[model samples]
Target: MHTTHHCKARQSQRGISLKMVNYVLTHGALENDKIVLGKKEAMQRLADLEREKRLLMKIADKGGVVVVADGEALITTYNCSHRN
Candidate 1:
């Protein structure tokens, strides 16, 4: 997550947030040492998330609440009827 001064300047100029850079790092395909998230890869990742959301929705419809946590800290909670 470390950014060089030049990188920070370019990011400001390009309006690319650190969050977006992290997303590309996490999900992007590796080319040599660089990570690249092209349009196709981005679309595929979004589609995969959508499929997971649908599955979670089905469970929620069955009166299940999906709780996502990190260790003991709750990250998110959701159901078909409500979200927290």
Candidate 2:
């Protein structure tokens, strides 16, 4: 899949803000359903809650978020302080 240069530029010029990066990483699965963000905004959009949960847990497992994926799961990515 192609990467969005918009994100790349944002991270390069200004360090990825914790809030915005968190949103991108979570795939719109915010805690308490309070963090307002468009569902369509996620890079790793899952079909439903179960899939989303699994995805988020997988992300939380690998040290916050790092762009990595395989055939078994969709390409999910995240950045705590930007993964160089």
Candidate 3:
């Protein structure tokens, strides 16, 4: 869950909260070096977590999230234009 200063700045600039970033990191799919959670993937994950109402409510947004990771630390995160 570690993030660089640059990543924190980007999160503030992009209005992407740390909670959302954590959600993407926990649920997103690995594509190359990034973890991506698009609308489609989010929907699928939502369905999978349907029984967990609280968890499901947390990640109900279909907006895409792309997280770049360096080992266990997070390098950066941004909203996905193409995936949404």
Please name the candidate that would achieve the greatest TM-score relative to the true structure: 1
At residue 51, candidate 2 shows an lDDT of 90
Q: For model 3, how does the per-residue alpha-carbon lDDT over 1-84 read when each residue is reduced to its tens digit?
A: 579999999999999998899999998889999999999988888777776775545444535567999899999987564752
TM-score, predicted candidate 3 vs. hidden true structure: 0.53
Instruction: State the displacement of the C-alpha of residue 80, model 1, in Å, after optimal TM-score superposition.
Output: 14
The 10-residue segment of model 3 with minimum total lDDT is 55-64
**Model 3: residues with Cα > 4 Å off, grouped in runs:** 51-84
How do these models rank on lDDT, best leading? 1, 3, 2
| lDDT over C-alpha atoms for residue 15 of model 1 | 100
lDDT of 1 by residue, 1-84 (tens): 678999999999999999999999898889998999999988998999999999988896767877899999999986545545
What's the lDDT for residue 72 in model 2? 75
Each model's C-alpha lDDT?
0.88, 0.64, 0.82
Candidate 3: deviation at residue 50, Å?
3.4
lDDT of 3: 0.82
> lDDT by residue for model 2 over 1-84, one digit each (tens)?
254888678777997675676665565546584544565744234456669788888777765765567977868766654455
lDDT of 1 at 26: 90
Model 3 per-residue lDDT at 75: 95
